[model samples]
Target chain A: MEPILFTLFGAIAVGGALLVVTRKNPMSAALSLIMSLFAVAALFVLRQAHFLAAIQVIVYAGAVVVLFIFVIMLINVPENRLPIEKPTVYRLLGVVAAGLLMIEGGLASRNFSAPATAVGEVGSVEAVGHALFTDYLFAFEVTSVLLLAAVVGATVLAKKKI
Target chain B: MMGPSAYLILSGILFAIGAIGVVARKNALIILMSVELMLNGVNVAFVAVGSYMGDPTGGIFAFMVMTVAAAEAAVGLSILIAIYRLKETIDITELSVLKW
Candidate 1:
């Protein structure tokens, strides 16, 4: 049962990612990204990180992807106006580099050992909140400040004028 | 349960795909999305390790990564919007004034 679920979600994640890269339209790509994000969230659940899965759905699939779609609509880049250039040297280079990275990363991960069972109830919201408020308090506070800065920056940058 | 290596390898593949998209795509928006993909890949790895090691700290770090990712997406998209307003196009290849 577990392996079946894993395979299903894994296929969704990888397949959606492929669509995100291959699609020419920004809106289509954004939609595919949503699929990929949802699949990743499911994978989180499979790993027993329930809270992380929820956050992934809310922040990523909910907010981030919607933001991308909104921008795509705002710009409304005409399909014909886009260059639609033929494959070039950069495309080849990108494939080669990506292939090498995959090889290296796969080799490194070969020694990883699976945990027989979850060590803690880290998947629960309470457990995560406890850690966030206690052990990671400083980092959490810093993240709040970072988010505030990002809000201000986005508004200032996106506005029509000062 | 699946081994940590499986998740890690999946992350590697996803990250590589994101990297390829970043390099191959011309649109700044697509590149930003690709950046998000790479970040997601890293998050998966963090969670896997944290779960395997029996430490919640890895999950904590993944939370931080998500926070940073949100910030990055907000700021990056805004910058892309501003750039489009200025140049009327979002293709990074043709808008290379920074190629000095």
Candidate 2:
């Protein structure tokens, strides 16, 4: 059951990601990214990170994607108005560079071997919350400050006359 | 069940594809989306590693990452909007004010 779920959702996630990069239409690409994010959330569930799964849905699928759609709609770039690139050598070089990156990353991951240590299960809401409030408390509080700064920065950037 | 390495490899592919999107695409919005893709890819690997080690740290780190991603999206979109208001376009190539 777990294996099947993994295969199905993994395929969906990767396929949706592929669609996201390939689609010319920003709206369509955004929708595909949303789908991909949902599938990744499923992967998180399979990993027993139930709280992360929920947060993934709420934060990414709900908020981030909506923000993207809002901007895409707000700007309203028609299909023909999308950026057009000349068939220059740089485009080919970019593709080659990315392909090399993929290869390097794949090889590195394949080489990573960790000893299988069996221990108590983690990732439940209670366990994660304990970790967050205890060992991670300082970082958690700092994140709040970072978020506040981000909010202020965004507001200032969006303002016309600052 | 698949090993953690399989998940890592999938994540690597996802990240790489996102890199392709970022490097190859012209639209800044798509580029930002690709950046999100790259973040997601890393998130998978982090969760997989945490699960393998029976630790909640991976999930905690992922939470931090999500928070950062949201903050980045907010700031990035606002900047994109300001750019659009000025040049009437969000093409990264067009906004080469920093290009030497």
Candidate 3:
């Protein structure tokens, strides 16, 4: 049952990713990205990182995906105006290169072995939060600053005549 | 439970697809979305490793990655919007001002 859930969600995740890349419409691609993100969140749940999974859904699906769709709507590109994506030789080469990279990554993944350690479920919200505030406190504080900068920068950049 | 290698392979596939989308796609928005996908692939690996290691540090790192991803998306889309307003097009191939 456990492996089944993983396989199902993992396949969906990969399939959604493929849809995201293949879909020409930005809205379709963005929506597919939400599906992909949701699948990843589900995978997180399978990993016993329940809190992170919820955060993933809230941040990624609830906020970021909506932002992408909103912009897509705001710009309102017509179907005809969408970029003409032809299958050029160079693009095919790029695909080949990416494929080679994927093969390499898969091969490398096989050699990974976790060091001998306690096999316990440690992804609860409390556990992860403790680590964030205690060990990763500096990084946590910096993320807030980063987010503030991003918000301000987005506002300025997206504004007209600024 | 599935081995970490399975999850890692899945991440590899996701990352590969994202890299392909970034390189092969012409639309700027799609490229940004692909970047998100790549980040997600890494996040999966993080959580998977963290779970196996019996520690929460990997998950902590993933949380940070998520934060960065959101920031990146906000700024990247803003840049995209700015580019569109100036050039009135989001096709990446034609907007080659940074080619120098």
Q: Score every model by TM-score.
A: 0.96, 0.95, 0.96
Per-residue alpha-carbon lDDT of candidate 1 for residues A36-124, written as tens digits (9 for 90 to 100): 99999998888789999999999999999999998999988899876475688988998999999999998887776755764777666
Candidate 1 colliding pairs, count: 0
Off by over 4 Å in 3: A115-118
Clashing pairs in 2: none
Runs off by more than 4 Å, candidate 2:
A85-87
User: Which candidate ranks first by lDDT, i.e. highest?
Assistant: 3
Residue lDDT tens for model 3, A1-162: 878998999999999999999998999999899999999999999999999999999999998899899889988889999999999875797689878988888777768888767667678989988898999999999999999999999999988876
Q: What digit string (tens of lDDT, one per residue) describes model 2 on residues A1-162?
A: 878998899999999999998888899999999999999999999989999999999999999999999999999987888998566676687678877987887777776765577735577899899999999999999999999999999999999864
lDDT of 1 by residue, B1-100 (tens): 5677878888888898899899898878888999999999999999878877877787898999999999999999999889888899988888889899
lDDT of 2 by residue, B2-100 (tens): 678878987887888888888888999999999999999999999988887788999899899999999999999999998998899988888998899
List, residue by residue over B1-100, the lDDT tens digit for candidate 3.
Answer: 5678888988888988898898899999999999999999999999999999898999998999999999999999999888988999999989998998
lDDT of each: 0.88, 0.89, 0.91
